[model samples]
Target: MHQLMHADLARAHLHERLADAERQRLAAYVVRVAKARRAARRAERAREQAQLRLRLLIN
Candidate 1:
C-alpha cells in the first residue's frame, strides 16, 4: 500500500513537470511568431518606400 502511494506521487510530479514544459514551449513559439510578423511588416514597408522612390524618379 505504501509503494502504491509512492508511485502515485511520482506520477503526479511527472505530470506537473510535463505541463510546465509545455507551457514554456508554447510561450516560446508565440514569441517567435510575433518576431516573424514584425519582420515581415518591416520588409513590406521597405518595399513600398522603394517603389515610391522609383515612381518619383520616373516622373
Candidate 2:
C-alpha cells in the first residue's frame, strides 16, 4: 500500500511538470506570434506612408 501511494504521488508530480512545460511552450508561441504581428503592422504603416509621400510629391 505504501509503495502504491508513492507511485501515485510520483505520477501526479510528473503530470504537473508536463502541464507546466506545455504552458511555457504556449506562452512562448504567443510571444512570437505577437512579435510577428507587430512587425507586420509596422511594415504596413511604412508602405502606406511611402505611398502618401509619393502622391504628395506628384501633386
Which numbered prediction scores highest in TM-score against the true structure? Answer: 1
lDDT of 1 by residue, 1-59 (tens): 99999999999999999999999999999999999999999999999999999999999
Clashing pairs in 2: none
Error of 2 at 50 (Å): 1.6
Consecutive 10-residue window with the lowest summed lDDT within model 1: 1-10
For model 2, what is the alpha-carbon lDDT of residue 28?
A: 100
Candidate 1 wrong stretches, greater than 4 Å: none
lDDT of each: 1.00, 1.00
Q: Model 2: how far is 49 from its true place, Å?
A: 1.1
| C-alpha RMSD of candidate 2 | 1.2
Error of 1 at 28 (Å): 0.4
